[model samples]
Target: MLRSDAAGNALGAGRLKRMIRYTSLAVALVVAGCATKDDVDDLALDETPAEVMFNEALALRAAGDVEDAANKFSELDRVYPYSEFARKSLINIAYLNFKMGNHSEAIAAAERFTTLYPGNEDSAYALFIIGESYFRQIPDVGRDQAVTGKALQAMREVIQRYPDSEYTKQARQRVRATEDQLAGKEMEVGRYYLTRRNYLASINRFKVVVTNYQTTRHVEEALYRLTESYYALGVVNEAQTAAAVLGHNFPQSEWYQDAYSLLQKGGLEPQESKGSWLSRAFGNMKLL
Candidate 1:
């Protein structure tokens, strides 16, 4: 009976050891399968050359694995900082991050590239990317326009520094759009103050649109609003001058007709006041 009992104990110990071994094997396999692409890239970093890593990143990007591709490109840059591939990788990283909707990251990468290789042929592209990053973040005209301002500044730099670049054309177009957006914001605020019967405050806002954003579509309406605001403030001469500027700039505009009607209702005519700034600016030109 003692021998049989010992044999039973040995068999049970063997089974327990086999179960532990199988569980460990299964855990290892699961870990291997769960290893992320970044983890794999990390593991290969020491073994892979920068060119190979860059190519891998490109392949991954083309395959629509943008996050992993960005990781691979970043790894290449980190591990081979002075390699030619490193510079190329930074540019790709910027563009890929932009495509991935990581605007801040895109801007950072592009800035880094431009700082490190300002004279490189692709530096214009990096600058363009920075401008585009800010441009894409511009909110509606009714919202704050700080980002629109930034976008305009960046785009202006692109145009001035790289006038011959292909990006310059697009930058010019974006500048116009950004300017219009800023003018729209000013118009929105002016109209809001007008609705609240704040004539002085509203006039200041509309004047910003007229003076700074004259090329924008908001200028016509700004001139009309200025006429209305000046009239409301009992400044009939300034109101008439504002209406005169509106008519001279945009005679066919509905805003001009409205301004003319408003001035006539106030027993004033739409004629330039010699003492007014609008008249000083537009008086030498023939009135339309």
Candidate 2:
């Protein structure tokens, strides 16, 4: 987006006329919205006080001119960098950009606010906006999860840095969602390897869900997959351990049933190994 107004600099006759027309429209809009004469003057002229500019931007937003409002806030920030209005304008820019679905711009603006005013009360909100921007851009489990990782990290930062802030609860929720997506991605890859009879590779992937993402919803399926992979590799002890873990943690889960049935097919049952990583991961839960 253009940083400076075209009319702010020297203009040719044609450009001047266009500016006049646009200015007239802006003035008409403010006037129609029951704005005072001063408000109309602020919209029609280049000489806006910081407070007036901030109010004008708010009026534009209220009038549903979101893009223009964001631009107006940007201009206010640029013109009054050290003023209190600048800080307010910067946060508004981030919020409006996010509302407009300009996620990247929202992230940039929010990051800028947080960096400039780390101690400000609005800094937590700015950080939340950055995390929300990344969360909104998260792709499906099939895609690279770099954005998901960033979202998770950003949300965690909000919780860690501003635990008492209003945004912390939602940030914590987003953290769980992002972690679930990452675990789902691993599960997808693990499933692919399993279908190709790549037992060891599949085991490695499912192990991630069990180890690093045990809190996620995918953990039950991850445990089942681990059982499947280890059984395919003729590692019966580990297979039993995995199935036992699944049954112990998710007794009613369909995945546990499947794991149990699979073991039964081989005249085996869900039994925990005396010493196994799966046992250690689940605090060595009792055998099923």
Candidate 3:
């Protein structure tokens, strides 16, 4: 996580995160196959010459000579198909392809690794990284989330198949972040409908987020929107209920504060009968 090599000039936290993520991937490729030769007596490669060439190509990648490094790796794989170095080299192929923005090629290379070495724990890492390659390229929400959907599916596969893997832990974190991003996109669409006085349509969209993505960071915001939407539709009981839930879950949240004011203005009078409809809806609270 150190920012610089020598002068200790620390980049921002975001830059540090990206550096760790990308470098750990590079390290995983090299480390994964270090002992691969132990399992094979004579891997079909021409050994001495192949090691020299592979080292040179690895160094090229380290120097950031990406295109040339890829060509070298390809040539090495061709000359020595089943060697330990070649197996490890495939991971680099995927990484370099992703770095060069060939997302499909990156995914294909990663798929080859997982297919050939499904039992290898490192394969899970490849799967998660493949998901990340596409996740980073997701289009604006208005355009499409096809790639985002695909990435989520792939990461979910990693988490399901390798529950204990560090990659699975990271994938879970990424999944939560991506889900929140998608939820925010949904909220944006809903807000558009609300702005146009299409309260019912907006309510439906926000409700979907609340029901399906309740774990996301957008849940509180969506609940507040629901409060407004219900009030707009003259559903004062539902509005008060939504506001009370928001308040209970997030006492200090500004969204809850706004929603509370909306509830009172809509005549749900938080101090109505202790067992009023909204009170029953919120459950176990003394609003008197």
Candidate 4:
């Protein structure tokens, strides 16, 4: 019986040791679980896929999340340089900047594209878009014309360098429109001077239209104004000369008819003069 008791005690000791080991293992597993949770939290900060992150940022912009979208786009551009995705992302950057009213950044991206891909078929188009970026900022004819000049220069580059390109055709039309706008600005300034009876300055502006901007629709109005300004300044012969030029250059123009009537009141009428480009074949012409 004593031997049986000793064996029972040893077996109990072994079982107690096994139970202690099991309890220790359970505690260790709980501690590991807490550690794993901490690791998962860290992973949440860095687990974003590149494309997935990019798209998420774009989606935020489409949902009116501008600032966040810009951050993501910039990050993508930095990380994925020279990729097809990156090239596409840059264009989106331009569009996003323009949408956010950042004209300077939009123009920079457009110009950079043209420089980086000069042989690209879309280079001219990129340039044309840069011109449009400036064109959109032009205010009324009475305001500062800095943006108008910028648009004109950019469009001129597009036309002079890409004459055969379809972009040239479109750009030429814009050029004409912009020229007309600038001419209108000149007329506005001229009209202001005329309203104040500053005939000399008014005539100078009108002369610019005749000399530098003859192709504009404002030419007819300018010529008529010149005739009137000359008459107001008591320059009768100059008034007649201007009226004659107007009648010769624009026979079908209503301004010509008006100038003729004004000349009649001044004891004169616009008479035919040998001053036309065709009539200049006569001896008095400047041609050799």
Candidate 5:
């Protein structure tokens, strides 16, 4: 009976030790949690309010500290994403980046603003910034025209979607400018192929200008080149059709004279074929 009592006492002591260990661990966790919460509170105290931060960013921009202003605007967006000041800061960030010639960054910020607030009045401004950024990045005609295409698309969106907005006029101008650039690119490639006697490839490129970019200055040359290419390819009827269309549209243009002269070399005069693709493309348009 004495041995049994001793065993019981030893087991109770073992259980008591486990309980003390568990209590100590619980207390440690509680203290750690309090410390973490205090750290968070301290960090919150360091953060500026959204309105104050945005104003500071504007001040920085007014003082010609554009880079610093952009950083401040971004910080406001990160810290107070749902605040009204944050929304304003987003559009301002796009404008500031554009002023600094960070065109791609400007486009990204503008696109984000449009995606988040599609119906907002500022959305027009944001889309205008996107189009302007792409316009600023447009390369020369000899370079790839992918950026020019993007500019045209973006600007056209601003014009079509927000016709009454202040940006619409500029957007229309940019649209025309981008169209000219794209047409110039097509003409450059067509000229290259034509110089190499790749008549079919050249004709395809010229046809793009004639069909899709008729308003561009390059269309006169495009039509003349089309006449040259078809005649070289032994498609004399199409050549006559091309030259007839060119002469009809741009009678005083040097390109029309050149087209007429070229056709005369092959004993053909400019005569329209009613079934020509050129006729279908320009027949209904007021090209004159």
Candidate 6:
């Protein structure tokens, strides 16, 4: 009886040990399987061909998934750096970054494309993209206009290097817009100085508009401000010359009318002053 009882106890202990071992093995296998699945999910992109990855990025962009599309394009370029698809991917990434309002990234990618493929037909487009990125970041005239200046420089590069490109027309338009923005910035500063009763500083700002950005929309206002500043400084001849230039260039402008009225209230008339900077400029143009 005692021997049978001992034999039953040993048999039960062996069965328990075997069960624990099997359970541990099963748990370990499950954990390993999950870990492998996680790795596979992480590396799923590794198996895709460059063309396939590029196409996927394009589809994502078309579907308005800009962030994902940019990531995929970057991934494609990284995975196949020497492929033609990689080169194309870089350009698409630039455009996508621009669309995503990532102006700095767009500029970097566009610049990179231009650097790598200087002779590519799309280099003009890349340069245009850089200009557009900077142009879009241009702040209000009340703020700094450093980005506007950069946009002008980039757009000028496009027009100068690729005159016949389709991008040149758009770049030229952007250049004009950037110039207007810069002129507007100058006008803002000039008006501030004028309001502060600093006629000399005001004249300097307004003169920049007239001399450097004469073709901008702000020219009429700048000329009117110049007239106001010179009059405030008690320089009647310069005031009259400024008013004359304003009237000559923008005869139908409200600014011209305002200048004329202000000069009339001072019992003075608009006339070109010989030997003045304005006279030299307008005289050369035969407009005075």
Per-residue lDDT tens digits for candidate 2, residues 1-288, read: 553555556445545754675577666777688777676555543446789999999999999999999999988886566789989999999999999999999999999999899999999999999999999999999999999999999999999999999999999899999999999999999999999999999999999999999999999999999999999899999999999988888899999999999999999998989778988888949765
Error of 3 at 137 (Å): 1.4
lDDT of 5 by residue, 1-288 (tens): 356888999878866754565456556756787545554433332256577898899999999999999998988886677779889999999999999999989999999999999999999999999999999999989999999999999999999899999999999999989999999999999999999999999999999999989999999999999999999999998999888888888899999999999988878899878788999998753322
Cα lDDT, model 1, residue 127? 93
TM-score against truth, every candidate: 0.79, 0.79, 0.67, 0.65, 0.82, 0.75
Report per-prediction Cα RMSD to one decimal. 13.5, 10.6, 16.1, 17.3, 13.4, 14.7
Instruction: State the displacement of the C-alpha of residue 214, model 1, in Å, after optimal TM-score superposition.
Output: 1.1
**Cα-based lDDT at residue 50, candidate 1:** 70
Q: lDDT per model, in order?
A: 0.87, 0.90, 0.77, 0.75, 0.88, 0.88
lDDT of 1 at 60: 97
**Higher-lDDT candidate of 4 and 6:** 6
* Clashes by residue pair, model 2: none
Q: Candidate 3: minimum summed lDDT over ten consecutive residues — where?
A: 38-47
The 10-residue segment of model 2 with minimum total lDDT is 2-11
What's model 2's lDDT at 126? 93
Candidate 3 lDDT (Cα, 0 to 1): 0.77
Model 6 per-residue lDDT tens digits across residues 1-288: 356878989878856754665456556767787545554444333447788999999999999999999999998987677789999999998999998899999999999999999999999999999999999888888888889999999999999999999999999899889989898889988899899999999999999989889889999999899899999889999899999988887899999999999999989889888868988766642344
Off by over 4 Å in 5: 1-46, 285-288
Residue 159, candidate 4: alpha-carbon lDDT: 91
Native-vs-model 1 lDDT? 0.87
Q: Please provide, for model 3 over 125-205, each residue's C-alpha lDDT reduced to its tens digit, 9 standing for 90 to 100.
A: 789878998788888777667787788888889889989888878899778877876787789999999999999999888
lDDT of 6: 0.88
Q: Highest TM-score among the candidates is held by which one?
A: 5
lDDT of 1 by residue, 1-288 (tens): 355878989878856754665456556655879755554433433437677888899999999999999998998887677789999999999999999899999999999999999999999999999999999999987789999998899899999999999999999999999999999999999899999999999998988887788899999999999999999889988898888888877889999999999977867788777888777655474544
State, as a TM-score between 0 and 1, how close model 5 is to the true structure: 0.82
